[model samples]
Target chain A: MNLLFILNKPPYSSDIGKESLDMALAHATFDDTVSLLFTGQGVWQLKTDQFAKLAGLKEFTRLYTGLDLYDIDQLFVSENALDTEQLTRDQLMVEASVLNDEAISRLINQQDRVFCL
Target chain B: MTTRFSILVTGSPFTSQAHHSAQCFVDALYSKGHQVTSVFLYGDGSYVANQLMHPANDESHPHQHWRELAQKHGFKLQACVSAAAKRGILSREDSELSGKSSFNVTSPYEIAGLGAWVEAVANSDKSLHFS
Candidate 1:
């Protein structure tokens, strides 16, 4: 199945971000076709140099670096979200293609399953 | 082709609108003659299956809606076992295995693993999630 996980929450602030990543990883582990689209506050999850340790939280963002090992390389980020957050592609911890609203919609339509968190 | 849907709910019943939205979506699917193959509750969404839930009469009872919908439509209503275990929501079998005298989840809502969710996603024509 073509599964697309749309993450819209900020990392570490709530469990949503971590849970969404876990769900994606779980699907990928089972050899399902899984993709991730980071939008809205979810873009913050990919921010470079996260200091979750200061907040006494484990750095879950580190998992994103290993996603490629699970064959979950179809990562995307919303261009508007990145711009709104004043972040650039260079600031992200992993490489992801930038997608505009139209592209994101197309991606969602193309997926057999969509899980928004 | 008839669209077979698999719905995923990951939000808490009390805190988020996910349960309400999921209920509405299922109702619409039924009205449109679409088949809802499964409804999988993950994360805090397992709370929606709690049989002990007793909301005030005036407020909307989303859990009851889920129960009724499952009964009426014969769709599988499942919750992630691990997630439900952590949240104190257990089926009768789970309660017995854990040596608990009481169970909070009842008919139409079964406890399963993430593998069940994966299967639902793979078998369904489209899967929608509310969180």
Candidate 2:
């Protein structure tokens, strides 16, 4: 089944943001086709130079690099969110397809299950 | 068509509206003669079955409400074991293994693994996430 996870929280501030990714990873490890869509403040989760240790949080952004091993390579980011945050693709740790509002709508429409993490 | 829904809740009881919305949705499904395979709690939602959460006498008790609903509908309420462990929601076995003196998991609420979650989803027609 195709599952889409919509992440909306910034990294480090909320523990759910990390546990939500862990859940997604668990699903992906089960061989399910999973996609991750980062929107709003969630886009910060993909930043390459993240040092969550300073905030007393585990550094997990680099885990995205290993997602492909679990066959979970469908990573997407909201173009509007990135622009709103003045972020560029160069700041991201892993490659992601930047999606517009319409594309995101279509992506969500095609999913069997969509969860807002 | 009787839809079998499997619910995933990721919000806390008192601080978030996710639980309230999920309960009402489950009620609507029950009213329509639909079935629920299971309600799986993850993230902060794992606190739903803390067993130690005793709200004010006049306030609605979320844990009791869910337990009663599960009993009435004959659906299992499962929380991810990993999630529960992270939040200090330990079972009797886990509490003992961890050298803790207290345990919180009660009847009708099972602290299980992701395999249980997958089975719950597989048994259902659709999975709805309330966060």
Candidate 3:
């Protein structure tokens, strides 16, 4: 259905972000032509070296690594969001396609279905 | 072109960039000749429709602005009933029961559930959320 899942929250704080990712993975595994966009606080969910032990939660970053394995590879990150949050590419685990506001506006228009979490 | 789209506002009006982002999204969509099928207010986004919001004269009135623009543009405004009730956004009946002078939720918008949101998704050609 050319679905695009946009995640706007960090992992472990709430189950919404993980549920969104799981939705994308499940849909992609079924060949739904899904894509993922990380915006705002959601960018932090892609950070590397995440250890959830201190937070009393399971490390879910590993789920992101399997995105490619399930063919949901069109991962995008808002350039403005990253810059505003002072995050560099090295701070993230996934290699994402950087997008500015104009780019994000355009990308959103291109999708058939967009689920923002 | 009768293109249909959905907007999900999940953040509070003043606390985050979601307000600006949502305004931009709605403006952009209509400017491009598309129609917003539904403006679904979820989570903190429900505050946007709070009827009691009255800012001072010098400041911009966000809630009023949204209501006017939405009504003028023929956009459907739907807030999650559960969210609104929890936040003290009473319906007409609730307002009467609580003895409020006027109902804040006076526009064409209605209070609905997630199933209604899924309905908007199903009816529209596209869905976009701002938070």
Candidate 4:
């Protein structure tokens, strides 16, 4: 299935986003195609310097690098959302392409199934 | 067309992408001729149906937008009753019977269970989760 996941929460503060990311990883590991779109506070999860002990949450930032191992490489962040949050790609731990709201909207409309976390 | 849905709105009216996304989905669904049968407002998303909300001069309240949309389009706005009651939002009768101070939920919207959300998924052609 062509699955799309829109993550809204920061990686460090909430278990929901983490669980959903784990689910995405699991699905991709099982040979499913998964695309990830980060918007709002969710863009914060991809930032650099995110360690488990400092954030007091399980560290999954490393998974961003390992996603290629599972073939779930379509990672994108909304440019407007990133700018609104004052985040830059240089601050992200993983390589992510920036998307405008129009692109994000189109992606959402095209997905076979979308899971937002 | 087939109805596709299952939504999650965690942000409150003050700061959240949930309301915007939900509205966009509604417009998109309608334009595409799909249907939205049930919307699940969990965590802070439950505030969409709060009847007592009156925004002051400062905030661009998303609650008002949701309220207007729900009223205008006949969308089913559901707040998790457990969360609603815990947060001191209930129907008038619920407030009187339970002895609560605030009544947060009323008509146009209803308090429901997670099973209802599951039922929506099962019955729909597809499920779209809005986080």
Assess every candidate by TM-score: 0.84, 0.95, 0.56, 0.52
> Which ranges of candidate 1 are over 4 A from the true structure?
A100-106, B92-103
Chain B TM per candidate, please? Answer: 0.96, 0.95, 0.86, 0.81
* Best model per lDDT: 1
Which DockQ values do the candidates obtain, in the order shown? 0.47, 0.60, 0.13, 0.14
lDDT, candidate 3, at B107: 73
Greater-lDDT candidate between 1 and 4: 1
List the candidate 3 regions with Cα displacement exceeding 4 Å.
A1-112, B94-103
Stretches off by above 4 angstroms in model 2 are: none
Writing each residue's lDDT as its tens digit, candidate 1 over B37-105 gives 789999899888899899999999988999999999999999988889978999999999999989998
lDDT of each: 0.89, 0.88, 0.78, 0.72
In terms of lDDT, the poorest run of 10 residues in model 4 chain A is A23-32
Q: How accurate is candidate 3 locally (lDDT)?
A: 0.78
**How far is each candidate from the true structure, as Cα RMSD in Å?**
2.7, 1.4, 7.7, 8.3
Q: Per-residue lDDT of B1-131 in model 4, one digit per residue for the tens?
A: 46655555656555677777877777677677676776767666676668777878686666676666678666677776655665666877778789777576767777876546545544566665554
TM-score of chain B of 1: 0.96
lDDT of 1 by residue, A6-91 (tens): 88989987777877787788788888999999999899999999999999998999999998899999999999999999999999
Model 4 DockQ class: incorrect
A1-117 in candidate 3: lDDT tens per residue?
Answer: 688888888887876675466546656766678788889989989888888888898787788877878888899999988998899988888889999999999988887777776
lDDT of 1 at B61: 93
